[model samples]
Target: MVWNWQQTDWPEFRYDSAALASLEETFLLRAGELFGAFHHVNPNDRDTLRIELISDEALKTSEIEGEILNRDSVQSSLRQQMGLDSETRRILPEERGIAEMMVTLYRTYGDSLTHYGLFSWHKMVMAGHRDIQIVGGYREHDDPMQVVSGPIGREKVHFEAPPSNQIRAEMDAFIEWFNGSAPDGKSPRPALLRSGIAHLYFESIHPFEDGNGRIGRALSEKALAQNLGQPTLIALAYTIERNRKTYYEILERSNKSNEITNWLVYFAETILEAQANTLTRIEFYIAKARLYDRLRGKLNPRQKKALARMFREGVEGFKGGLSAENYIRITGASRATTTRDLQDLVDKGALTRTGERRHTRYWLANTQTDQSPIERRGV
Candidate 1:
């Protein structure tokens, strides 16, 4: 069927109340409270957290594009694309841009009562890599209907429109509504709902020749900040990457219907998941913090500094231990001071030594597990 682009008006779509209700149920007051805590973390700490989350999200999204989706491979792709000069390993470039953008979004939210500038959000993502084209902004070229992949193993489908020069105009209108008119002047919708809608609207527009999905997702987070009063702490990108097919299918079905209920519902559910995961991480951090605190009375300043650094950078090698040399570099302490600190930590039962003599290193006294016993206490 030849679809007429000019004939497609967003108002023709209907909102599904049932779907919206289901979506709202997912983000009860408790979820919001948890998300608020996640938002209060330091921006640098948040950036560090996102480095892991976005790396996983980008990998998962790539897998949706039919590439192998895993932590290591995705990390490799990110390293080269981002030009992160590493002393030992590669870092993903997208993570850098995403982290930087989120910080800007968060800072902007604090300063303005209404932080819904599409250009500002767009500029944040564009700052690092304009050459990437960001996937979903208005197209300057042929402006053909954008197609994304279908159900796994199925052929891709395009959002086709009858050939017309007004393709650009159609795209522009979507952006204008998306960035400007969608939120009424009075009580704006909650950030989560607005973000969900922004995701839907931008995808429906299919504005860019490429990178629409990535940019659309980014816009969703920006909307979340404006509506929710906090930028995201959860890894919603990872959630979408995990349920890529369901995500697209919901969008497709909802786009054909009136009120974007299904799409919004799905986005809400994912937000809940992302928020929950973030809470889980926060619990771990608190637990870890307490554990570190418990040792503070037992540790000297040097030992405490070294341990703090270890927690931040993560333990290295399969042994999951640090050497005297590594401690010296991390603490910027003298070799004798590093040795004394390591020995003191070992004496205090905060760390344990592994290997013999020259090959020896120190590891956290506790064993590593996905969810530490301390973490279960919620710190």
Candidate 2:
């Protein structure tokens, strides 16, 4: 029988600080840099970036659990929560539920984590879903909860959670520690390390019959926000999704081992990656702002809409840039008008034309000039 963390001395999760010292320093430094960059963004761009970041986090968290949500609906739900205009005309209950939970977690970053709070969050996340079998509060039965992989009849048990009876006491202890621990106090554990431990511990407890993974990730984000003294836009789930296989393997390995140094290291590295990715997005937003300023009076509404789409899609924005037909479809313009618009953009140097005749397409010109904000910062 594999001994889980609960079978150990409990509450005391020990690891060598010297082992993770370098990583801890690196993560903290990067997190500081990301936060500093965020502070420099103008109010308009900051709000836009916040919307994008939260939407990505909510969508990716659900996607990790094999639940694919419509991105537009999620965006609309988040927009409504943020008091912005929603693009989607209709919102699904699932989208609204996830968005509500995300906004709550973000806005209430300083609040104490409680049993009732977790129950409410679970209820909100599971609200209006007809197919889920688990109740919102907690597991009521004594059935063993196991995580398994492989074929249905020949499943390989990866890990078994503590029996249902242990959940109440275990959760209470978790809540207490989470509420009390501070990164800067006399007995200090780095916030990133606490985030990793909290995540693994919550998942191991398996308090809910379902949605454990999503909730566990959300708890980690909450811990990070508390440490920073503000809400963070770092999307850890996006990084985790890219490293999904390694994520599960490390969790199982740590659960079975006496030392969780490896898990801590992995968690630190993931935070670094997430912060770096977020920095890139911030840079992109800065670039977008500069581009908009440059073309403020040069481009028409259709051109501006098309350019916005290109910026949003990044490298994935239409393989060879957007063609005339594509522009027409997006802007609801007739062919003749679309042609004139495209030519106008090319003439104004906002876009560069490629190929000829029906094969012609337009790509955003190099918008960063010598004096642009992104260029000034050497980005």
The best candidate by lDDT is 2
TM-score of 1: 0.58
Global lDDT for candidate 1?
Answer: 0.56
- List model 1 lDDT by residue over 3-104, tens digit each: 323345543444554555544555556467666665665554654455555565554444554544346544444443444424445434444444444445
Off-target runs (Cα >4 Å) in candidate 2 are: 85-88, 184-187, 314-325, 328-379
**Superposing all C-alpha atoms, what RMSD in Å does each candidate have to the true structure?**
9.1, 5.1
Candidate 1 wrongly placed segments (more than 4 Å)? 2-11, 25-28, 35-96, 109-137, 148-155, 161-168, 179-187, 190-192, 255-259, 296-379
Error of 2 at 150 (Å): 2.3
Q: Estimate, for each residue in 1-379, the C-alpha lDDT of model 2 and write its tens digit.
A: 6656555666577777776677668767878888898888898777777878888888888888887888778888888888887465888877888888898998997788888889878987786776656657778567788898899799988888888888888888788778777554445457788788889888878889888898999998888887878887796988788778878878887777556777777786777677777777776677667767877888879888888777767423468778988898889999999989988888877778889887887887764222111111100
- Provide the lowest-lDDT 10-residue window in model 2: 370-379
Model 2 pairs whose backbones collide: none
